[model samples]
Target: MTVSENDTRSPLLTVRDLAVDFRTTDGIVHAVEGVDIEVYPGETVAIVGESGSGKSTTAMAVIGLLAKGGTVANGSISFDGRELVGLSENELRKVRGNQIGMVPQDPMSNLNPVAKIGTQIAETLLAHGQATRHNVNEKVVETLTAAGLPDAERRAKQYPHEFSGGMRQRALIAIGLACRPRLLIADEPTSALDVTVQRTILDQIATMTQEIGTSVLLITHDLGLAAERAARVVVMHRGRVVEQGPAQQILNDPQHPYTQALVKAAPSVAAARLQPQVFATERGVADGSDGSGGSDGFAGSDGSGGSATAKPIDNIVEIEGLTKVYPKRGSKEDFYAVKDVSLSIPRGETVAIVGESGSGKTTTARMLLKVIEPTAGVMRFDGQDVAHLKGKELRSFRQKVQPIFQDPYSSLNPMFTIERIIAEPLEFYKRGNSAQRRAKVRELMESVALPNSMLHRYPSELSGGQRQRVAIARALALDPELIVCDEPVSALDVLVQDQILTLLSDLQRERGLSYLFISHDLAVVRLISDYVCVMKDGELVEAASSEEIFTNPRDPYTRRLLASIPGNELKIAS
Candidate 1:
């Protein structure tokens, strides 16, 4: 599927010297300028970049779906020999679902919460004239089945709330492909899902689109994903196309500095750097460059981006036979969310627990944080039984342990300034006087690499990464010995995620911090963990050093997780 520069077929989508502008409150902002791309029938092309790099904006301009205050300032968007730049709303509506389709990023935000899944898909089918009212029900099920959802008929009747994140994503894919359009634009389609689910959804897209001979324009921040899925990769940076070439070519030897940084920052490529022998020999993964200018895999950031942490000599926290059981309704058997799980976090090191959704990883973290009481277990922190702590001891334990949550947008208070957000804990604990607390807040901000100028800015004024930095600063305000990091970098792009990981690692070394890291992303787990714990179905199935786990995994499930990593099969050696 490698499409060369001289690809002969007339592109299904072509943008020639496109320029886009937005009317911001401050002034007119040029979002995209002089950008060009093509998508041939049945070919896949990716637009990869950071959040504000104009990748998504370029895609939106193609479908005439620009946000308010945005418009195409110049150039032409030719789709199947028809120009779409100046089309009216009515004209564009006719062309949208019938000729082109889009699957946006967040499924929860896109799906209609008040409507049934079938009704939503039916609306698209009816609008596109793909099905009549009498046969629309049957068509809906067919579409869902094609999108790889099992029991489509029953699933169709459920609301969006009833479906899991992966299931909801499948429904979006079904709706996007229902019209069988000539082009499909998937924007960050699998950014939030687990590796296994992400692979399933992408596979379904590839199969369904190839069957229909539909072209794909994938928008994502993951270079490894683009390398694995798309035939060509278009690297964007600061509202411009920095480079364009074959997927493997860009992945192996990127020309642009930003592109090289992205490759090195990717989890799949970085994790591969840990122990290339495991993947190169036993798993059929060939030796390849990690885009860090090294023959062997080396994800550059001080030459140890994904290497295992040094072993620590002390246990900061330990658990014995942890279990949590919830009673079912109407005499059904009690459900076990976490059962007999035992693990320990070494002092001044990171321990990662990885599993898919409903795998009890989060449940176990909650128990460790004392957010939820375990049914039967002995939890010890600093050699004290945490379950028996009450009054001042419990409050002191709370001060010593803190949580850095998943979503940066929700973790901080929008109404408060960054200074207040960071200073709240210090104020609550009565750590110092007003002036001292403010100084402490500034110190925490500086520790997390935030500027002093942004002290008075609200959370809404900051980007996702900035807000996450603020979250870390808040967590560090209490000077906790242990931090329960629940997917702290899951929502961030590669570059920002790399910064956060680096910050965490530095903090651990400086302050002797212990991290109980929980995530479904094995790649990130590989990058930041000293010991790896593999969980499934409420049980701890495998536990070992990060180096041993990634290289020579003994458990089949662990091997499967490694195999599903994006770009796991790509040979970037040359």
Candidate 2:
């Protein structure tokens, strides 16, 4: 795992014994150990690791994005024949977004809300003087189009909030590549997107970088993405490069145990084992039950666990003729996010709601939550019509049904400690006093298998998975009967996801919690749900027991979703 001085020649970007320490109240925290990575010209190299493996710290270090109190105490970073260590903020600013570009993981926060997409991209070009005032607009259009945004000219006028998650991500990349920087650091750029969108964006990135001879430092947890996109893969663990080699070799014939564990931990790999070698989940795909004998889904191969069998349950929540229409603001035409969708979730059950991005899954969940009043339809929770409820009744309703958002990081208050974040709900609900709330927070943390010591840590101190566990603990603090889990584990690693799923299953059994789980990841749904509801284009295409859906799918769209999963009997090299 050690790279000596002999390994430094002809490297576009070189790191020698990089170390990062965060100054905290608990004293200096060693965030990154002595780490080293190399990115050569025209090379697409990936830094792959689980949450808290220090993959991101190294990426941030390479680009000088490490914030205040985070010091790179050791190591020298040489990029493009220049020493990057000890550069002033202003000096680094000149290099960043010009010679070295970054595609941050979360586009929602990365993009400026007030700026138009075109202007944001144009600013990058303007910063580097790549385009004059008059030419910047044209260059922006061309760049946006290259990033795979259709009708770049018209789309350019839109603000960051107007674009969908995938499109917003493209805009971020467009901004990053507006000047065609020599090195592009993509940090989990495809994680927020669906499989199709992920492939398209990755392809666009790969093609654009290759065409311009730009090297890429791809930081991601998705091993499949690393395999498909990166030429060389560097497996990182706890701020160290445990393994580095060709993608095919590292992925198929992984030498490091951690790398092998990551590959084996893929939910898609579990999907590969299903009969017909397809994945079946709540992702609006017909439970891959075509009788193809491709037998395998989340059914754990080792026999310790497997995909959940879909079974009938007593009704807990039901939506009849659900419809949500959004006014086009300046226009009279309305956007129908959910259309005539009917679904039912039984007590102590999980019903997966699957769809591509912008398929109205979130809108549907919101309608059920009554966060946004439904344009039409009847939502019944615990056998009461909730659609028409308002005021205090709605507040009471929300207490009984809570949600776990897709990004647990943002859902949590960054300024508050984990204890306070979880305690906020308990305080608001007037469930207990300060001491009682603290006790409840600890209990909730224990339920999620989080370390009690983390109770005092802030969001900035915890890893993605740990932060997600905090979110779950906070959700459970309300002691709700039905929890709407929206892509809860989509932002996490496979191993973390497995642990979360196991925790959720254990919670359901122990607490008898009913869950309306919504996600595009079918394998995860199969692992947890008792029933499945497949949605496509704002409509429910099919609904059945988990076993019935997987064994006897009646919808073609459902079947296609199953087929789209990347793994099947194909034994990856390692």
Candidate 3:
């Protein structure tokens, strides 16, 4: 994936003075205003911003995917000299998925759950007349294989539920690239994937586009990813273009205030956790506590200065020889999701488990939460074995340990308001009367940095970050000593991720909270964790203090995981 000198060629896609609006009950909401962008042939350009910044809305308008009540009030979208703003539905049909292919953010929502993977790809091919009825199957297989899925035939027969998150994303990529369109719009294509899978999927996209001389308009909130993959970067904020320049320049020496805030907030660019001085200096400036700058509260010192050499305190949770095995449907042998995992978390400290998908991280977390019974081994919580606790003891244990899930959208209930969601735990525990519960809910909301006025709103009205904050607030309603945060910030954009990480750090400092953090993002692990545990193939490959793991990793797998972070290979401007 090399950057091409496509400036000599005419632009493949151009948007000039674009403005979009949506009619709502309140009034007309302007989503995009006077936004300008261009993508040259065979070049990759990225549009990056926080959620509701209008980047995704602009892309949707260009691809004719605006939802009902949304309209392109004013703008000129031209692809290959064809104006797209005023095109009819039939005319746009011929252009969409044929001339301009789109890979949406969420695979499960976009994909047909009832259809086979191959059939879906085949439908896309047949709809665009890219393949004849006879060779459609062959084309589907070829496309899947090209997108890096192994044993394409077997995978094609499986439904979406049978596929892992990474595999499902690959199928979507295959569908997007099946026709080899002249331009591709990938909207946060790998936001839900692990780092390793994200690298592979991105590499596949770059290779395919470079081979076909196709232009790419990448939409993401990850600045490191934008710097690593794109030739040019466009920064959007509040429905306006704030900055546009070469990717490295914008990352290294961003002139715009918002762009500078984004660079400072990106954890991937921060120093490793082991070096206290370096970490303090870099993080202090980013967080605006160094006395040298004052900006959005996106970055702040985590105060983990002496955690590397700090002595272990009292044990909050301890696991020994923990294992989980499931019977194979058609075989006598068992499948082990977790095997002989041993680790301990100290009181008021965070221990992070980092690994790729299907590597037993989530399984280990589930076992700790007692969501599933471990097939073998013992789990001790504050000095008592909890593996077989029942009745009152189990209920007591539940109050001490809570969980924050990965997908905020699915974890929350649509029928419930924010107030009800937070108050349910209090009601379940019979903690207090109606007035007391309401007061507690408002306190929880304040602790999570959300306004109490939103108490009556449902989850659908909030953004991804806000929804996740609500989830956190609900988890904290029980005042749990140890929270099992499973990929809590992976789906968020860089700025929102920074805010959440900072919020967690602040809470830990103030409340003396302990966390069993499980995530695939090493950079984030470095920011908030005191100890690090690396897992592979359901086994603990390495376990050490956070400093030792980041600075002196002994295991090959650990080193590989560190090296796979995005933008690590590139020479980012200082």
Best by TM-score: 1
TM accuracy, model 3? 0.89
lDDT, residue 93, model 2: 90
Better of 2 and 3 by lDDT: 3
Candidate 2 per-residue lDDT over residues 41-82, each given as its tens digit: 887888988877888888898878887789898988999879
Instruction: Point out where model 2 deviates above 4 Å.
Output: 1-11, 20-30, 69-72, 80-99, 269-313, 370-372, 381-400, 409-445, 450-467, 474-480, 542-574
Kindly give the stretch of ten consecutive residues in candidate 1 with the minimal lDDT sum. Answer: 292-301
Q: Better model by lDDT, 1 or 3? A: 1
Best by lDDT: 1
lDDT of 3 by residue, 1-574 (tens): 3344554666889999999999999899999999999888788999999988999999999988998899999979999988998889999998888889899988898899999999999999999998999999889999999988999988999999999888898899899888889999999998888888888889999888888887889999888888899989999999999999889889878999999899878876245442122222232212223332111111111223233444333678878888999999999999999999888776777889999988899999999999999999989999999998999999999999999998888999999999999999899999889999999999999999999999999999999899999999999999999999999998887888888888887888778788999999998898888777889989888776676667667789988888878876666544
Error of 1 at 148 (Å): 1.3
Give me the overall lDDT of model 3. 0.85
TM-scores for all candidates: the values are: 0.92, 0.78, 0.89
Alpha carbon lDDT at 72, candidate 3: 96
Worst 10 residues of 3 by lDDT: 292-301
